[model samples]
Target: MRMRAAILFEQGRPRPYAASRPLQVEEVALEGPGRGEVLIEVAAAGLCHSDLSAIEGIRPRPLPVVIGHEGAGIVRECGQGVTDLRPGDHVVTVFVSSCGTCRYCVRGRPNICPSGFAARAAGTLLSGARRIRRLNGEAVNHGSGLSLFAQYAVVARRAMVRIDPDVPLEDAAIFGCAVMTGAGAVLNTARLEAGEAIAIVGLGGVGMNALFAALAAGAERIVAVDANAEKLGLARQWGATDTFLATEPDCAGKVRAATDGGLDTVIETAGTIRAMELAHAITARGGRTVSAGLPASDAAFSYLHAQLVSDEKSILGSYMGSCVPERDIPRFLGLYRRGRLPVERLKSGFLGLDAINEGFDRLAEGGVLRQILRPNA
Candidate 1:
């Protein structure tokens, strides 16, 4: 089957992506699902900063690939030996598709499944196969197991989680990446106690979700920090106990002072060394600093070893919110349904596939949060 999809042929294109057009909309050949795989008619996909990093060459991926990782859709068909899901089931497309028998999966940490890691790096599905190809028969690499930028996708069964049909697909789209990474950082990685105070550095989709998760978990104080005053304003409206501009003079000192020396936990989601530094600086002694950001592969953040040891502080990295999709996606979605997680507020708007490059321009400009891409629109 030939389908319209976004293909990234090169990385590090000039900014104002509308002009440079890093993701080219092309008609490509898509094969039917193989055994243990599923075919999906994509309903909604979200533009993520991770994708932006790929476009900017911040994190290079396999070339000549159809790139899209965060999405939700309806199942069109299921391959052999697949039993849990069938045609017409609504599901969320997760980037990390774990092999159930992998050591990490057996340990209940599928988020770091080595098989998934190798597959993503090699641009194949969990089965080590590429389901898409250029019209001329050249193979097109899959993006994180789900090339969902197209109208349809063939993915590993582990790449999808059956979802409640009542929830809007556009809203569900954010769940795949932003909600999991952000909220999971707070709830799963940090494990903030109800009375513990926490600060979220960077108010992008992930940071904001950390803030929301803190609130829902009954944190004593939730501090929101961002360079964008508008995002800070949104944080305030959404129930941040305090809002601080990252650019303010002595911002870290102020946050530390205001929270009575420091917060119990600080989550960094900006994917920058500076944000990591700030998050670490504001964490209370004996508290933990969790980094959920995906900075350029070569980028690094440093801290004083002596201070860390003396303070008894710890730093942790969270990938995909340290989530086990089968368990966490539904848990988070339940929170959303109960209105405890108001993820709907994070939806900035929608876009058609042709407007995706412009959408990336807006994302790079920090003008939007999570823009849902409606491929069929």
Candidate 2:
């Protein structure tokens, strides 16, 4: 089959993607699903910061890859031995495809499955196969095992979870990454409970979702922090008890004061060392600080070990919100259906494949939330 896809051939392109054109929409050859895989016609895909990281060389990947990890689609065909899902079923893509036999998968933490990491790093399916290629016969790598930026994708069976058809595909698309990571950071990683004071740093799609999850979990105080005032305003609209601009000279002090000393937990979603530092500083004694963001591979942060031991503060790194997609996605969707998790409010708008460069430009410029790409449009 032939389809149009946004392919990133190199990393660290200059900003104003509208000019640099990091991702080129080109006609590519796609293969059918092999064993234990399925073919999906992508309904919608969300533009996430992780994708931007790849473009900026913050997160490097195999070049000439189709870069999209968050998406929802309809199953168009099934590979051999796949009986759990059928053609025409709606499903959401999971960037991490766990091999059930791996130690992490057996322990219920598939987010860090060793095999999954290798597949993503190698830019191939869990089966170690390349299903996309250029018209000139050069093999193209799959990004995060789901290469959903194209009109269609061939992914491992473990890379998708069946979803209710009634749910909006655009809304469900975000659950694949931002919503799951943010909300999971609150509910799973932090184990936030009623009356717990919590703060979320970075008011992007993931941060806002963390706020929404905090409210749903009955958190006592929720402070939203961001460098952008406009994003801070949006946080207030999304039910944040308070908002803080990171640009304030005493932002950490203000956050501590807002929580009447410090917060019980602080979740950092900004993926910056600076934000992680602020998140740790604002956590009260005997509190936990969670980071769900993906910083650059070579990036590092320093913290005072003395304070960590004296204050009994714990720092947890949360990848994919420590989520088990098959279990958490359905649970989160149930919350959405009951109107508890209003992720729909986070949608910035929709874009076609041709406007994908502009979409990244908007993401890089800030103030934009989840921008859905309608590949079939």
**Which tens-of-lDDT digit does each residue in 190-279 have in candidate 2?**
999999888999988999889989999998878889999999988888788888999999999988876777888999999999999999
TM-scores for all predictions: 0.99, 0.99
Residue-wise C-alpha lDDT for candidate 1, range 155-175, written one tens digit per residue: 999888999899999989889
lDDT of each: 0.91, 0.93
Model 1 Cα shift for residue 268 (angstroms): 0.5
Candidate 1 weakest lDDT stretch, 10 residues: 190-199
lDDT of 2: 0.93
Residue 125 lDDT in candidate 2: 94
The lDDT of model 1 is: 0.91
